[model samples]
Target: MSKILLVEARLHLRDGASLLFTIALPLMLLVFLGRAAGPAFPALMVMLSVLTLSFTVLPTVLATYRHQGVLRRMSTTPVSPLRVLAVQLLINLVVAVVSTGLLMAFGPGLPRNLPGFLLVFVLGTAALMAMGLVIAALAPNGKAAPTIGSAVMFPLMFVSGMWVPREYLPEVVRVIGDYSVAGPFARALGDTWVGQAPHLPHLLVLAVGLVVSGALAVRVFRWE
Candidate 1:
């Protein structure tokens, strides 16, 4: 497992474009939108980073591996192909932590409710990644994975107030956003950032998303 992790890490590092986009894009956006977003800026930036990893990077890598027969071949070895999926998840999590660390070091401000922030962060990230796993499981091939993920990601981002503030969105859209994974994640993190406990409904939405998406991914995922 350790060897697989090391090899996978090295392979991931070779994808220079992905690394740059995942780490640099959010910081660059912060530079332009920091003052405008005010207190919500850091949370928005962190959410963007997390969403990018969960929707774009993760599914693409896993689907590509399966499409290339990598996962299929792994079945012949001592290691289970599932370990590769786990490693990929771990690597993406590390990237997310680094991105968040950078935001803390250089962004507008840190979350005031540290414990609550961590709790929301964990649940939100897990839920989002579980959805990504479902994308990886269902996508027909590498070429289709990013297409499917982006289709799902963009609408969620829109409703989550990535482009427009939730206060500005229509009441119907806001209600739907409350139930979406990204929406709850954004709201929960924003609440925690301002030193408030996350709303109970937002936590429940995230937990439910994690369970449903995780079970679906495990049930439908194929080595090939």
Candidate 2:
């Protein structure tokens, strides 16, 4: 398992295109929008990092392995397919962390409420990544995984205030966005960044989503 994790991490690093794009896109956005975009952009970009790994990179990698019979062949060996999946997830987590770190380095100051921010970040990452796992498990093939992930990603982005800030949206749309996973995610993180305690309702939503989605993903995951 350790070896697999190391190899996957190295492979992710070696993939220059992926590494550059994931790291670069957020950094560029920060440099350009950091001043004008206000406090929420940093958290949004962090969420974007998580989203990229979850909805884009993760599903493609897992589904491709299944499509190419890698997972199937691994079944003949002592290693469990779950181990490979875990390693893939661990690698992506590193990617997300690095991406977020870069944004923090160049973009904005640290979150005012350090502990609160950390809690929101951890829960948000888990909830979003678990959603990605479900997409990976259900996708029929490598090509389809990205498509499905993207389909899911755009709406979440919209509701999460990627396109329009939640504050600017009308009451109806704001209400919908509030209920969406991305909505509470951004809210909790934003609140913590500004030194305010995250709202209980937002934390509760994330906790429930994390538990329910993770359980479903594990239950439905396929080795091949």
Candidate 3:
């Protein structure tokens, strides 16, 4: 497992595009948009990092591995195919953590409610990653994964107030955003960023999303 993890981490490092998008892009956006975003800036940066990994990086890598027979080859080895999936998840989790640290260190401010922020971050990331796994499971080929992921990502981002402030969104849209995983995740992080405990409803939504999406991904995922 350790050997596979090290090898996979090296491969991920070599994917310059994914590294730039996942780590560098968020920081760049923060420099340009932080003032406009106000206190929510850190939350937005964190969300951007998470979404990039969940929608763009995770699914694309898994789908590409499947398409190129990497997973199949692993299945034939002594190592379990499931171990690869776990390793990928761990690697992405580390990236997200590092991204968050950078945002807090170099960006505008720290998360005021550290414990609450951590709680929301964990549930939210797991839920989003589970959704990405679903995309990976359903994608027909490597090329199709990003297409499908982007299709899903943009709408969720809009609803989550990535493009527009939540205060400015239509009432109907706000309500829909409240229930969406990205929505609650954003709101929860925002709450914690400002020193408030995350809303119970947001936490519940994320928890439910994690359970349902995780189950679906497990059921639908293919080793080959």
Candidate 4:
């Protein structure tokens, strides 16, 4: 597994688009938004980092391997295809964590409730990764994964106040954002960053997403 992880890490670095989305874009957003909106911006950028890995990077890699018969070949070997997927998820999780660290180091304020923030961050990252796995499981090929992921990603971003602030959104939109995974995840993170206990409802929503999506992904996953 460690060897597989190292190989995946090399492949990830070789893929310029993957590097850009997973690392460069999030850091850029942190600098730009952190300057404009203060600590809230870094919190949101953290969410964006998770989304980039979950929606774009994870799905693409898994689908591509499946499309190329990589997963099928692995099934006949000592290396399990499931291990490959696990390694990919682990790599992306590292990227998200490192991105968050960069924000904390350079951004103005630190998360006041460190334990609470970590709780939200871990759960939120798992939920999003589960969602990404579902996409990887369902997409017929590499080309289709991005399309499906984008369809899901845009609505999530919009409802999460990526486009418009939740406070300024219409009542209906705000209500949707309240329930959407991204919205609650971002809110919980921001609240904890300011030393507040995260709202229970938000935590529950993310937990549910993690379980449901993970189950579906496992149930429907294919090697090729």
Q: Kindly list the per-residue Cα lDDT of model 3 for residues 1-224, writing each as its tens digit.
A: 99999999999999999879888989888877888768877898899899989987999989999999989998888988899999999999999999999888888768899999999999999999999999999998889998999999999999999889989999999999998899999999999999999999999999999999999999999988
Off by over 4 Å in 1: none
Instruction: Give every collision pair in model 2.
Output: none
In order of listing, the candidates' clash counts read 0, 0, 0, 0
lDDT of each: 0.90, 0.85, 0.93, 0.88
If both were scored by lDDT, which would come out higher, candidate 1 or candidate 3?
A: 3
Model 1 lDDT at residue 118: 94
RMSD, one per candidate, in order: 1.0, 1.4, 1.0, 1.2
State candidate 4's TM-score. Answer: 0.96
Weakest lDDT window of 10 consecutive positions for candidate 2: 13-22
**Backbone clashes in model 3, listed as residue pairs:** none
The alpha-carbon deviation from the true structure for residue 224 of candidate 3, after best TM-score superposition, in angstroms, is: 1.8
lDDT of 2 by residue, 1-224 (tens): 99998888888888786776678887898899888998767888888777878887888889989989999999999987879988998888888888878887897778889799889888888898899999999999988998999999889888777898777877888887787777899888888887899999999888998999899998998878
TM-score of each: 0.97, 0.95, 0.97, 0.96
Sort by lDDT, top down from the best: 3, 1, 4, 2
Model 4: per-residue Cα lDDT at residue 201: 98
What are the per-residue Cα lDDT tens digits for candidate 1 across 1-224? Answer: 89989998998899887777778888888777787777867888889889888988999999999999999998899888989999999999999989888887787667999899999999999999999999998888888998999999999999999889899999999989989999999989988988999999999999999999999989999889
